[model samples]
Target: MNLELPLAELTALLLASVRAAAWLVVSPPFNSRTIPSALKALLSVAIALPVVPTLVGKVPQLDTAEMVVSLAEQVVLGAALGFLTSLLFSAVQAAGNLIDLFGGFSVAFAFDPLDASGSTGNGVFGRFYNVTAITLLFATGAHQLVLRGFTMSYKALPLDGAMSLHNLQHLLTNGLVEMFMAALQIAGPLIAVLFCADIGLGLLSRVAPALNAFALGFPVKILLTLGGAGLAMTMLPQAVSTVVDKAVTAVMQAIGS
Candidate 1:
């Protein structure tokens, strides 16, 4: 028995894998440090498998220079798609950061080993929210939906399509706006209470100088934040779902799908 492999399909699969590899390197929860790079590489190839047939016909002639250029394009395209997706999902972590800022927890910054960025300056709530969001993504099977969205990108962008910088810029700007707004929505009520608490403490300080209201402020705000965070956690499942949908939408829009 002899086995035959079509060169065009092989080239297409390799190109598709390159794109998926770049995306996996940048997107979460696949991008988390807990996931080994080797696993990511395998997963990328797996992800590109279904798209291979669609891409085979689109595969351009691959001389050395064209191959290099094509490989670079795939990386950029995949990274841009992943970045847009990540930007939408970052809203949850951003909300936690805002909570930490308002709740006086920012002072206790420590390293989050699970974070892809390997940043050592995240506060307690920020890391908590990020971890929880990732867990929810897997538990609810939203990661599959995210993968489905990426696979759909080939139809819109294709292997030979050139990405539009102007459109990418527009989507990027909108993603940022949406990210900030989403973060505010999640942390807003808590922030408002904290703000009121601050104002009350200021008033109390002015009225009764003998009693250091500022001293009480820390404990009071901490209690409120804890309570608020507990309540806010109940909303995470829904928020994660919404973010997943938004992430998919952002990816499709980025590729003009």
Candidate 2:
């Protein structure tokens, strides 16, 4: 028994799946190793289904250099879009890193088993923020926006669209810049408080040599970090809302423009 789809439909599915698979391979939540490849393939198919009809007319014939080039193009396009989707999450992680740095918890970083990258700053503040941010991501329905953006990207950048690898360097540069700016915006207040704590400790050290201000630095800073951490955590739900709004805009602008 031979079950077969029409060649045109099959081609559309494969190409669309390739793009979807490439995106899932790189993008977060889906990028986690705990997600099985079979599930990923199924999700790819599910995603590809809606977009296949739009690509039917544009399906490039699979032959010679043209096919290879087109395959590469699909992969590149998926990766770029995936990177765009991940930018704001990187900012969240960066904010965590900043909190860790200022709180003197940089020394506490350990190999995170849950981290696919194997390296992560598992500082108290950053880890807590990461957990809460992820919780808010699901609770606020931001994941739906992410999936919407994924599907919407194809309309903005078609399967056969031109992609210049040269632009990749610029994308990365801009993403990093945005990451730092967003991190500062999220963690800037707590960081400033920590800075003021440092200054106060320095002044107190000069006032009483035997007071052991340097010895108090760790506990005082930890207290300060914990004290303001709740306020910073509260900002995350709103930040997640803002980030999701901006993320969709970024996705559209990145692909559409």
For each candidate, what TM-score against the reference? 0.93, 0.88
- How does candidate 1 fare on TM-score? 0.93
lDDT (tens digit, per residue) of candidate 2 on 97-124:
7888999876665545556463754675
Off by over 4 Å in 1: 1-5, 110-118
Q: Each model's C-alpha lDDT?
A: 0.91, 0.79
Clash totals for all models, in order?
A: 0, 0
Least accurate stretch of 10 residues (summed lDDT) in model 2? 109-118
Evaluate residue 247 in candidate 1 and report its C-alpha lDDT on the 0 to 100 scale. Answer: 89
Q: Which candidate is the best by lDDT?
A: 1
Please, what's the RMSD in Å of model 1?
A: 2.6
